[model samples]
Target: MPASAFDDLDSYIALPRVEALALSPDGRRAVLTVAALRKDATGYERSLWEVPADGSGGPRRLTRSAKGEAGAAFTAGGDVLFVSARPDGDDAPEAGQLWLLPAAGGEARPVTRLAGGVSSLAAVAEASASVIVSADLLPAATTLEDEAVLRKKRKDKKVSAILHDAYPVRHWDHDLGPADPHLLALDLSALDDTIAAAVADEAAEDAEATMDASTPYPSSLPRPRDLTPAPRRSADVEGAALTPDGATLFAGMRRSLPRGSRSILVAIDVASGERAVLFDEDGVDFGEPVVSHDGQTLAFVRRDRGSAERPFDAAVWVCALDGSGARRVAADWDRWPTQLVFDADDTALIATADQDGRGPVFRLPLDGAPVLQLTDDHYAYSHVGVDRARGGYVALRSSWVESPHPVRIDADGAVTPLATPAPVPSTTAKLTEVETEASDGTRIRGWLVLPEGADAATPAPLLLWIHGGPFASWNAWSWRWAPLLAAARGYAVLLPDPGLSTGYGLEFVARGWNAWGREPYTDLMAIADAVVARDDIDADKTAAMGGSFGGYMANWVAGHTDRFRAIVTHASLWALDQFGPTTDDSEFWSRIFTAEGMASHSPHHSVAEIRTPMLVIHGDKDYRVPIGEGLRLWSELAEHHADDDGRLPHRFLYFPDENHWILSPQHTVIWYQTVFAFLDEHVHGREFVRPELLG
Candidate 1:
């Protein structure tokens, strides 16, 4: 909490950030998954462990993911189902295969592969039966019907500190080939006895397969009548709910397309072609709807505007079958309600709330009653589930400080811990905080991490690192490994949470409105100046680096100042004019920053001003900040173009497989290594990039 706290990355993160919790329909079992960091062969392995739901049982291992996974569910028969990356799949496949493990502990079975990738999975029961879901494999191709892949390249862009936000549109990217994602529906009946789903058959090796455009849910049971004659893709459906007789199916779709219209909720008789639009939110969204046991009421998460990381403050609203008598049962304005559950008797609503510090599971009555806590002292009590048939609740819990560990509560209220905690390398650096005044005289807060073994007797090189989310802040608790590696190499790190930082107050962050590359950049320089004044930091040898919004800032700084010896940009957008029109939030950027001003700050248009030696990393398939931006910047530098100062040297590293995020442990390590090498070469006077590492 000081200007020198960056001296070392804290070894352990704070704990008890948990999913408040979730229960099963039978109320027999529960699962608790905890997020913990552990070292594997490469480095830290963030994973999920499991345990009983009610309050008893030894912890179990559910997922051994590296970056970790979310959204774990329970099958009717009490099997645990969830999504995660698979080694057998492409690198960063991200299809999120549906994995199943018996509630009592057994080998995880891949029901089926999600070809495009299963973004979501919902379970339902019929006639007191159970269904086993092999896998709702995403279709390898959505439309082979025409014998031609209707490929359309969609380009979207944005700026990030490290260019770490979006992936470019690439032909052979991870999402290419038979991986055209279409929303598919799969229903594992009561106890998972009978299965039904909307599937796309990819059996045609050389030809396109035609869809019936009818009942989509593939099932071992008889084909349900086509409620939707047009049979739109599952991607069009946001949520699904089954009736008591398993006869009716309800679905929701995103409505912000074409012209941003109202979202529609429709009902389809699974057994007959009876379909109807129950309701529509003119300018809002109501999705992830679940039907009450009585089949007369519907509940869903409703809000206004999505896709731009909108604050997910949705309330649980229930309405009659006709879409009338709508009333909000529970709402959380501050935090997103990750999960919602209704007791079998339909008398109580168990909701997962993360409003304050962390999430905690709570049980509330449907009629009306103060919410009651079900679990205490947990951080991210999320990835929660209930295997009522298995007799407990299960969840994956994660902490902001330490690696996540899965914990569960059994029928009798006993808690069990699972998985070993992860180990992070000891930080040779110190972590501290500093406050400075921006050019506009606005107060800005920052986290300054001094290099290890550097003090008044020895000044260390400095790396002014920025965070993405002009709205996101770097506070006491945040995860950024790049600076740690730099510190390990004897360079100081400075992370400043300028105006528009969350957690402080809504008003503080508002100061950053339309102020990109201006005050925010000023804050960065101020923090650098303040830190370098200390005997422990060397100003002349300082460097700059960041991803996404941070990436954009890096581009901006490299173009305007010769202060940095070297700079690295990742998944960044360089041209604001290009980004303004393509971004999903184009209107938003225009409304807040004005379209013209945003274009003026873009680095692409001002490339002639760049002077620093720079490295740019772009994921080939990044849709958020696409690789084109990287290519643009790289090409400009390759042209040997002289800036206002002089000639600039640059290198562009393109990750063909990665998306908006870097997922491979090996790639992550290499990426950090490159960052430190660049800093060390310029800041510490050591050739940073390894010649052998580059191909």
Candidate 2:
């Protein structure tokens, strides 16, 4: 692999990325979404593709359109149904519509044309063709046509204001406003009949009728029935699953509390419009419901709301469909399960969890047996699709060395690549895992990316890159925070899993819950010390950088020590008190922090002690940390710091349209260019070079 591969951002963004996988009912065919940069080079477009479940044939593209497709699923009949925004030639709604492609090979056609677009899709496992979808709805609108009219009227009147009686007005990156998400049940049988009639009529018109056949035929679509006809005020439902018989639907509904909101699982009868609470506890939130194929058991996650002493912990819980014999599964397993599905026999469950430094799949038995480890590798697995007939599963596998690709995991524990749309980058950097002992004797582990030509004779500069989610581990491949770019610039990047990081047990996370500036901080420094002592690392030319919680740590590091030549913080929480109240998810933070705790741990108070050169990066639409934190930190630095010249020893890079992350292709390129330039000027003692894109 050549180092020049990482030097160009265009080539990096052009690489095909794979996400989400769905298997057919028979498990012989699998479909996954692939996103690639559009021909215009402005943004990415996603399309559905089919791959052989046995990893035998080349992947074939299924759908191609200017507006791409996503949220793919296989109907019980083995037909592919996906959501897309392709425009209908007639007076159809402009938002996303459900489209279908037959398993026998045919042009994809729309199934429904909802006004506000389809947000999610689900199907019954046993039934032939029963489906449920969710879409955004306008206030007081009963039908799709009415909602469309309301949208047009609002657009004509230029009414953009949203009247909210709820506490939260915005989510992570978007406003949670005038319209809300609502569930709808699609009449798939009726839709199939309508399409069949249209095709028959065209054939009957002439025996020699020869249609273009390649182009999609738009038939009269069937209207969906509103499941939640009259939802509660500001209600937002998610994580919906259907029973094998398609008679019942289980979903998570958010209910507001004094400090925050908690999601409780509720079961809805598909035909009678009757709803019942399946599980609801006082301090524990429930979500991600998965019903067994036998329809006798229901499994979901229970998350405990934290206090100053204990932070949140997610555990898997199972209960009978009749709301009896509820118990927690995998009670002894220290790792937390994210997504799971029941095995074919319904006697065991398979799930993926962050462990050590990788996300591995685990099998938990309902018969009181010990949990079994299914996968042991450096790659992270997500969006798992199980094939009961083959007794195997497929998942999107990714690691630091490779991008996401579809891989089949056989019953015998063997993994084979199903599709590789993008080629791996050519690089000479070596990726290795390292571990060190903290002052408290706790073991800290991290991934070290040593650049090419880095040896004792020519030591490489070091960059300590901390991960966000203070709760998440660095186990997966990330194009955004890729270390290859830094390694291309002759820097060795260290991605450490300090305290509060997942994959470690609860005891490890509890070490930094209330003492954010204590254990986690020290664990990070301890690992850095171990790496700096390596013969191939330049100890003096080191820098620290992070985003979100990692950004918060970078701020803390800048103020506490002058060991690093420079520091970079992005979307960081500087003043915990102010941030706790102003953030989008304020209630979650408020529940965990006390007034004294905020005062003692916040990085804002210690800003005056900073003597290192710093680069502060933030996005205006970052509701997670909020732009106010960046403004405050920048203003404080300008007021408090002064170098030999009149200029302040700091710089600020602001993104007005971006959210917490710089997602745009050009913007991402500029981000890396600016960061490298800053590090070079400060750490390498080189002249400051401004990026051409910024100018």
Candidate 3:
């Protein structure tokens, strides 16, 4: 048997990871973006690999550079288009630039050299070589040349400030920006002509052998046409698709309001650069646009804004390209679809949604028939790309037992995994399902991971792992919070999806909507009670831990009960009234929570009741849950529990440079180290051994 990666943090972090998949138009090949830990072990670098869609051959590396590449899309000619910050000649782009890997198989060449490098491939025409990419452009610049000059001036003057006239000045981790994103269109023929001229000039010089990296491509390339000009701050393109002929583009554009913004679908003429609103309504936002094979129909997701009384609802909607004949798909279905793509036959649409603790693929017909599930498994599927010609699909599937990898799904729901360089890591832990009934008679279920020798004779310590999102499920695998690591330390971890978790019907979410401390709290306690009753779990030795909304629940659990020996909260919501207006997006938070509801559920009111030791972790750069929350939490803990000598049983781990999540490689290792140490001290009655790096 193979060794479990959880045995060693270094070995676990060194494992190769795969993300994102792009299938060719003919469904012959797939390009996967795989990230491997760098040689220095400071970060991970991504590379493109070609995998045979038929599963006949092994994966082959396509591109290699220090800067790495991602966001791959296939053009009509089978060429792979990706964005990378790799150097061309002596100049390294400040941002990622669009690069093309030719179908004929030579060397990847740069396509666009803009002041703000291309960010992502927006849309690719099926019948034409034209492509659209999203890039950031200064609002003051009218042309690409003008933008270049303005950027140079700013760099020379060392001006790092941005004047915002909008509601949200910052997002989750970073500032919103000095430049807004715009969609740019490029004609491949013009680029081809320019490349031909450069090659001819090099031949005329008769210096092919001497053609170093400095002069491989021409200095003057055809500039891309800016499809969106003067978009200001409202140009956040959420999703986009192009017509078969590349003559029209349908995109979800964010419309800025006095306090916030809402997304609306728009159609832009490819040639004339004219845009018209295709769908816009009050109190609703639309995104994830997809066009059919024939380009006559459009599909997108419509989200009805939520209120204090009820949570928001998302529905699949389809209409013509001209914005007529709009109707909801599968109106009777309770599942909320997250992805949409037209199948080969175009008679039905293929989509994916969370269901029964897993996100499975489904086929919904245009005639409003019953929705049919395409995949029946324990894995959650994402990045679904439909095979237009063969009526098949390619996607990335993952579960609690395995990491994400590329797979091909047939029309009959058969799945064949494509070759990947990363092999699934083994673990000594075992997974099993546990369910119980809440006080309200609602069924609550979760996954329990047990260490290798756990039994009635030697019951393992328990860890109640509450998932964040309060709206997310515990179906998918997560590197950040892998339960196997705890199992490797002879601990059992329980992952419970309580109320407000998706996949469950809307009614289940509503049970905890206005009353966060009610159903969600009771559901978690109910599931934990059932698990602790098992002979293989130690009922007296347990702890509760969570982050974000989960963190809120952990605090609530601490104040309401004394069952758990310890608690861990990360980026938590300590005070409802202070948090509502201080978060990154106040409008969305305020709309969903009323003053009365917040007061009734606020965890800060119970601070005086908390008796369990706690570990509070937060990032200073986290704008979503500001650092003030952690500071307030630490202060309250001291004021309530500290002795005359100012000593308390609580600890606060702060990261000044990290965002909401600990992203750096070293920092992530420290995060796990501190968490394990804290748990050992409180739950296992072991001495509190502080991590060496913290000192």
Best by TM-score: 3
Q: What's each prediction's TM-score?
A: 0.66, 0.95, 0.95
The whole-model lDDT of each prediction reads 0.56, 0.84, 0.87
Give a tens-digit lDDT track for model 3, residues 609-664: 99999999999999999999999999999999999999998999999998788887
> Which has the better TM-score: candidate 1, or candidate 2?
2
- Tens-digit lDDT track of model 2 for 1-695: 33466767767777777877888888887788888887877678999888888888778889999899999988878889999989865556678888888888878888876767787775444664567887778867765656766887888899999987767888889887588777777767767545576676356533433542221223345567777776643237647788887888888877777645788888888877688987788888888889898889999888887788887888888998766898989899988887889988899889999999999878899887999988877888998878888787888888877777888897766898886555455677889899999987899999999999999999999999999998999999998899988887899999999999999899998989877899889999999999999999999899999999999999999999999999999999998888998998888887777777778999999989998999999999999999999999999998789656758878999999999998887788788888999999999999989999787
- Lowest-scoring 10 consecutive residues by lDDT in candidate 2? 211-220
**lDDT of each residue in 1-695, candidate 1, tens digit only:** 52332332232222222332334456544444444434442334333454344445454556665645545555555566666655433322345655566767755655434333455554454332322222222132333222122111111233221211122112223332222223333444411222222222223321232543322222222211223332323234666666655666667754444322334677665544466777675546667777666677777777654322322234677777667888777443333455775554566655676433345666656676665667665354655554435544555554333334455645344556543332223445676767767677776766676666887778887778877766555532334444555665576778777554554444454555565777667777787787878877776787888888889989988988998899988888788777655553444454456655566667786687777889898887676676777887887776656456764556666788886667555566567667666767766677655745556
* Candidate 2 collision pairs: 1-426
> What does the lDDT come to for candidate 1?
0.56
